[model samples]
Target: MVVRVFHTATALANTLAADVARALRSNPRLVLGLPAGRTPIPLYDELARLHRAGRADFRRARAFNLDEFVGVTAKHAGSYRAFMRRHFFDRINVPKARVDAPRGGARDVERECARYERAIARAGGIDLQILGLGLNGHVGFNEPASALIARTHRARLSLKTRRANAPLFGDRVSAVPREAISVGMATILEARRVVLIATGESKAAAVHQLVEGPVTTRLPASLLQLHPRAEIWIDRDAASRLRGARAAALRRLRRSRRGRSRGRRAAARARGSR
Candidate 1:
């Protein structure tokens, strides 16, 4: 795992969007796992801009949302499906039918989870999975636990998440769904690559925990330690706690590399002049 810390959320979003755009170029039929929340809004907006500029091609791309609230119509204003449509799929060229998300308000949730998993399998699994970490280090609603589940399924929301998400539901905690269906940790880890974006000081503790702490299900995002190709992009505020002598030393090493590269370029220019 690697961390790319930016000074602002917008910069982080642009960087992440550029990475996704590059991935699309390599594989036009890329399957992306998307998350819906305030964190990823700027990223989606930047991606939309790239698509409009003809720098991104999503015509053959497919998307699957990370999770959705139960007990709500897909058309509901606060639904994840509505959030995805408004923030991403609506602005991009991804076909409406190819953008898959679990059906909410389904009387048979077991069938919903099964069918969602099967759909993902049929699509050849996701090429890149984007994620947002919960305050408790949860990833895609797989909250703190002693063990991680390995498939798509429904989960009860933790109190902290419910409280934090209340404002999205008109500041009515009761209106927030206690349950949501999420792609499991195993499913997320199966992606060819994964990108986790986080911003704000409110996310500092979680970021520090997942980056430098133990790989325990108690902090679900820590499972990334086991992933071969997962990267995290964070803003300065979110990385506040990670600042230290060791980080400063690493920064010095990076600057040294840049200085050497610049020196080599100067020598090459001098030779050309001669």
Candidate 2:
């Protein structure tokens, strides 16, 4: 697991977007696991900007959303399908047919989930999965629990999650679906690379737990700690509550940067003096 801290949201977005572009360049057919939420908007926006700049291309890539409201369809204004189209897909070159999102409105939900998993296998698994940290440390609606589901499955949404998504439903928390179809924890862990991003003081506690806390099913995100290739990107506000070695390491990194800056300035001054 790797943690990257940025001083500002823009810095974080730019850095991560560059990383994504590099990955896409490395594998033009990269399969992506994407998340939907306010936290990832900046990154999506940056990636779209990168595409426009010719720094990245998505025409050959495929994408799968992390989750969707159980009873919702693509036509719903607040559906994740709609969200991705508005925030990302419409702005990039990726074809609409190449994007695969769970069919929450399918007549046979279980069969639909099985089909989604099968589709992933046919595509050779996901190359990289982008995620967002929930206020409760949940990942893709895999809420805090004694044990988490292992594959793509239907999950009950926690009240907090519904409340968080209320704005999408016209600020009526009750309008938010109480259930969702999500890629399970085990499925997420299987991805070749995982990138979880968080920002703002509201996410400080969850970010702290994700980085320094114990690995338990209670906070599903802590499972990322066990993944061999997980990258966490967050800004100073989201990293505010981290402590112990994690905190010290960030401090040391800052000091090293300052030292390098001063040394470069001194070298330039000496050269001018000579």
Write the residue-wise lDDT of candidate 1 on 1-274 in tens digits: 8777776799889988898899999999999999988999999999999999999989999999998888877989889999999988899888888899988888998899999999999999999999998889998889887787788898888999888788779999988999998899999999989999889999999998988888898998998988899998887778777756535744665567689899999999999999
**What would the TM-score be for candidate 1 when compared with the true structure?**
0.89
- Residue 255 CA displacement from its true place in model 2, Å: 6.2
| Lowest lDDT 10-residue stretch of candidate 1 | 245-254
Q: What's the TM-score of every candidate structure?
A: 0.89, 0.92
**Candidate 1 overall Cα lDDT vs. reference?**
0.89
Question: Candidate 2 residues 237-272, lDDT tens each?
Answer: 888888987787667767777898999999999999
Count residue pairs with overlapping backbones in model 1.
Answer: 0
Total backbone collisions, model 2: 0
Tell me the whole-model lDDT of each prediction, alpha carbons only.
0.89, 0.92
